[model samples]
Target: MHIAEITAVMKLPSNVRYEYFIKKVTDFEEVWGLFSDAWATSKDEDGNLFIPFFPKKEFAEISAEKEWALYKARSISLDDFIEKWLAGMKKDGIIPSIFPLGNDMAAVSIDVLLKDLEMELENY
Candidate 1:
């Protein structure tokens, strides 16, 4: 199957966040226009990554009891297009997520504008 857009959601603190377009990827208007949910979790967790596990689980488990599992998607191989897009995006300003990088307190964001990622399974 063909992938339209890729979004990698990550959590972050309330400050030091992304606030601009890194690159103008073609056919990613829908992804660019839509705002991805990112934020910090409660102060009880070991890590501050505020990932809502429900959505992830919904995209996993293929069972006889749910349809949300239909949203699950898998890739066949990491295509060169993804690398090219990421390189262009990095050059344009999109950088690696800072969750485990530079700072500990920063706003969360998603940055998967990679292109032409072949899908082996697009249950979604």
Candidate 2:
């Protein structure tokens, strides 16, 4: 039931831009978790610190349909929330590599590599 490789990153071809690699991870919670974890230095109104990143429990609370649209609105600047997360992933060295002609291939492969992919958080 476990795939250790889900957490493992592999090498992509050399032609794709790393930035767009960040742009394709539009699955809502995936983008939210990655970004929330990476830039979690924000504070709440009362000055108590609040991290946007979801815990496993919180993630489990999301429904696949709504989370995507909601998170997309919150996270994505151009294409989708996943793409934005891909940018964050690249910043954190989470993505392996990319190629020009193999852009679609690279994204698909990356998704395979991160096989723990779930849409649970997409419920919003």
Candidate 3:
């Protein structure tokens, strides 16, 4: 995907983008994230840290600018994301920011994401 396509996806409504994230990740069996020395993260007004993920590498690539300049897009297999990452993130109280577009994102809990992904996969 290119920047133009990404821009269109970004313009999509929050719930639509969230659905797109889940579908794309499950369809590809992978999720994209920006990483350098650590995973790329953002904070809410309350100062809670959340790691952002993308359903497409292009999304991650476009986000890897400014403060995230040193970060590179990396792919995480869905299985690892589910069986390992999610549980660890849940224990650590880290929110998963799905398909963020600027200041907007679907910042959901690990359990919520897991349940949604499971439901989506059930249709397959």
The top-ranked prediction according to lDDT is 3
Off by over 4 Å in 2: 1-31, 34-38, 41-78, 95-124
lDDT of 3 by residue, 3-122 (tens): 687878888987899999999999999999999998998888898889999999988988898889999999999999999989999998889999888888888878889999999999
- lDDT per residue as tens, model 1, 34-60: 012422122224443221111122111
Q: Write candidate 2's Cα lDDT for 23-92 as tens digits.
A: 3343323333323223322333455332232212222123112323233112333233335554565455
What is candidate 3's TM-score against the reference?
0.94
**Model 1 worst lDDT run, 10 consecutive residues:** 51-60
- By TM-score, rank the candidates, best first: 3, 2, 1
TM values, all candidates: 0.20, 0.21, 0.94
Q: State the lDDT at 88 in candidate 1.
A: 57
Task: List all candidate RMSDs to the true structure.
Answer: 14.6, 15.0, 1.3
The global C-alpha lDDT for each of the candidates, from Candidate 1 onward, is 0.25, 0.31, 0.91
Compared with the true structure, the alpha-carbon lDDT of candidate 3 equals 0.91
